[model samples]
Target: MSTEMISITSYCLKYDIEGSFIDSLEDGGLIEIVWVNNERFIPYSVLPQLERYIRWHYELDINPEGIETIQYLLYKIDLLKQEAADLRSRLKVYEGTK
Candidate 1:
């Protein structure tokens, strides 16, 4: 799939977020900023994550550290889910051979 790059300034304006908030996310290694033609951009793929962070900050009143921790835990949960699916598939394959 092709990803579109959006300017950070435009994104912050559209979302009513501060640029420094995004900068903090970048510092925490949750998302990356790309520089194209002297403009900072974020990939479209990060929209979901960005939105989640926004909700956490606004609705849940979570700080950046809490958001980062939640992000890491969610990532771990996804990894564990994938691992469980893989193990189940392997078990099914072994059963088929029996």
Candidate 2:
């Protein structure tokens, strides 16, 4: 088992322990809407859900393929940014409604 991080997709992500997927989560990554069959499709609702098994991916040092590694990290940052945006939007919505 190793603690590592990799971005599975733009929206849905996977965290694994010992080569087994342990957790999956939703954070509004752009890939969420890319799979739509049509423009009329709702982007937010169609987003894939992170599977139940994924868990925290600890920072690690094992090197992956250079280009793949860069893509993975960039998407991870995107996930985090989307999460922050979602949280902030939710907070503002609740505050305004109160």
TM-score leader: 1
Worst 10 residues of 2 by lDDT: 19-28
Backbone clashes in model 2, listed as residue pairs: 22-53, 22-54, 23-53, 23-54, 23-55, 24-50, 25-50
Q: What TM-score quantifies how close candidate 1 is to the native fold?
A: 0.78
Best by lDDT: 1
lDDT of 1 at 89: 100
In candidate 1, which residue ranges exceed 4 Å CA deviation?
1-3, 90-98
- Clash counts per candidate, in order, are 0, 7
For each of the candidates, the C-alpha root-mean-square deviation to the true structure, in angstroms, is 2.6, 16.1
Candidate 1, 16-91: lDDT as tens digits? 9999989988898888888888999999888888888888988998888888999889989999999999999999
Residue-level error in angstroms, candidate 1, position 12: 1.3
Please provide, for model 2 over 1-98, each residue's C-alpha lDDT reduced to its tens digit, 9 standing for 90 to 100. 43223333432323233322211112223223232343212143332322211212334332223323454688799999999999999999999998
The 0-to-1 C-alpha lDDT of every candidate, in the order given, reads: 0.90, 0.38
Instruction: Quote the positional error of residue 75 for candidate 2 in Å.
Output: 0.7
